[model samples]
Target: MTEHTESYYAASANEYAPFPALTESIHCDVCVVGGGFTGLSSALHLAEQGYDVVVLESARVGFGASGRNGGQLVNSYSRDIDVIESSYGADAAKMLGSMMFEGGEIIRERISRYRIDCDYREGGLFVALNHRQMSTLEEQKANWERYGNSQLTLLDEEAIGREVASERYVGALLDRSGGHIHPLNLAIGEAQAIKLNGGRIFEQSPVVKIEHGSPAIVKTAHGQVTARYVLIAGNAYLGDKLEPKLAKRSMPCGTQIVATAPLPADVAKKLIPANYCVEDCNYLLDYYRLTADNRLLYGGGVVYGARDPDDVERLIVPKMLKTFPQLEGVKVDYRWTGNFLLTMSRMPQFGRLENNIYYMQGYSGHGVTCTHLAGRLIAEALRGDAERFDAFARLPHYPFPGGRNLRIPFTAMGAAYYSLRDRLGV
Candidate 1:
């Protein structure tokens, strides 16, 4: 019964054919659970490699965070490479740094190879609200440079204003390699590409149980899939009925987004002349970009336990107006919320269960590109190349301190502390 939210992305999504639900037992080389970016990307790669792949979704493809996200194809992990270097060591950081941009590259390569049009734009800006954030961006630029990212430029206050037309930023960093897109369309296009490659996708097929063996059996309400390998990429929206162990290591966090009514083309150009997607540097950040049809898609705010509010637009519109006071009376054309998995360390979780089954989740708020990277690494491991996959698997993950019940308030307190620091520009 899961369905796509009534958001701008859903309304404007490219033609996506409805996939039939699983009604009979079937067999495949790999059965992937969750049909968002991770599962779809993994299935596409596996299908291209000639594996008999089948994807199962609790709802339509891209019905979760993948479709509802802010659509920025940003590079790197959630915690950043410097944090990785400090925690893991120079060697681990170097290895991770090497793969930072590959995820974005994978996205571009797919769009070109498959000729999928998702209104792919080619610029992104990380803005600073104060000197502390600017310093952080300087360090980030230097850190990314060491990792072979040369498409970066630091912008001063004046340059930042010129790039964004907003006076809210003190400085900014532009990454030429970073970009934005219609995320839902990208997922739908990839699903279509997978179908064209002969992979099967069943929508509205919630996995009720998983019976594991040398070959695992994935059961839906009316059908089942027996596969040599089972890859679970169901991140935040994944329920715990199937696997409680995977659910504990990460917590689901909800985020809200609002889209303004289409403005005049000239007014849109005046608002963000460069048309680059921008995100501010803060614990709870605001991200926005101009859509293809001239609407401003703005997103921010978070609920730690993934408890969605009834009035998403009311919660997010004020933040948007705070950033752009000129749009104080702008009509909100669409509003929605989505959940993403968050880990204590702000890093993704990649590991295997029962040898033949694998799972990857915990991208935090940086799923757009990292999911693609995870998909690639998972596929490599399935093909007998486990070196890269093991690298991510080595990163440690911990359960929430207060367990399931109290983790929400505990994490909210921690987030509030950082948010206070951000507000004070500490």
Candidate 2:
């Protein structure tokens, strides 16, 4: 059995009954593979509608990126609405814009209806380091406003300084709707809700292969699941292993995060007066928030290839200190790395495999809210309402410029170009 990684989330995770592994062949109306946000959300939605559902997880709940991400409830895709409009057409963008904020709404709905204790906080900040970045943020705010996001307020230098206690940012965009949470707890809580709705979840059941057909069969190491409909929610970790076709189209990349030991409440408040999660506007941005226990959780830097670094603190601590030099000499209580699936388009990839099998993945780095949105969309499609879901599916997703053998270096070069532009402030 694969145990959960030793991260702050795992150490401080809520206690729950362990789910059993699949030991006997089982049949159900829907077989959801993966126990993360997408699968859990899909199962919960379907279960609420009285569908027979069975969830198979390779490891414990929230064992992958769903658990290890910097817990920010960001409210957009990796490639924002403007990019969607420019790349696709205005019509396509309009169709997607309607659902842009629905993911965060679904998250809030789940939290309220089920009472998931994930330290739900409200508000997020997009801090700009220079005039160039601030200009881009202004444009971003306008674009978001065009799509009906009226919760945004631009903060000038003095206003942001008062809120963040930092001089690095010239300004910031405060999104009242965007917020942060204890991500792992959200996942586990949703999984528990799934069970309450009459869904069965099997942990430690890695899917070895999936037979695509009208009634597909998902085979695990110890058992098999036969279902009329199959929802493939395994994004970064299971794509290459179980579905090679999807593998050629996406790459997994690693991001590191570090959690400082609990700071004095006064110190924490001084660092972030409003307790809003903050991220820079750089191509390779740094994001930080205060944990429920007052620990400063900071994350940044990405490895093109999804390989855990030997030292997580070495990669993220410097970035944290640069933003908050007041945190110098603070001891880091936990450090870890997690992989998120990235597509060449940097947009999410959603589509159907064969006839009854559906697969959704590739959130780039914005999975917190998007995954929950995907779950609702996938459930809708399965229930014969594919309009909203099909809009995302209609977008095309291609493999990286180079194939799998060279995708890492190719993506790294593209990121480097953007990083240079950010450094030059042009």
Residue range 3-105, candidate 1, lDDT tens digits: 8999999999998669999999999999999999999999999999999999999999999999999999999999899899999998888888899999999
Q: State the displacement of the C-alpha of residue 128, model 2, in Å, after optimal TM-score superposition.
A: 0.3
Query: What is the TM-score of candidate 2?
Result: 0.99
lDDT of each: 0.93, 0.92
Runs of candidate 2 with Cα error greater than 4 angstroms are none
lDDT of 2 by residue, 37-63 (tens): 989988998999989999999999999
Per-candidate TM-score against the hidden true structure: 0.99, 0.99
RMSD in angstroms, candidate 2?
0.8
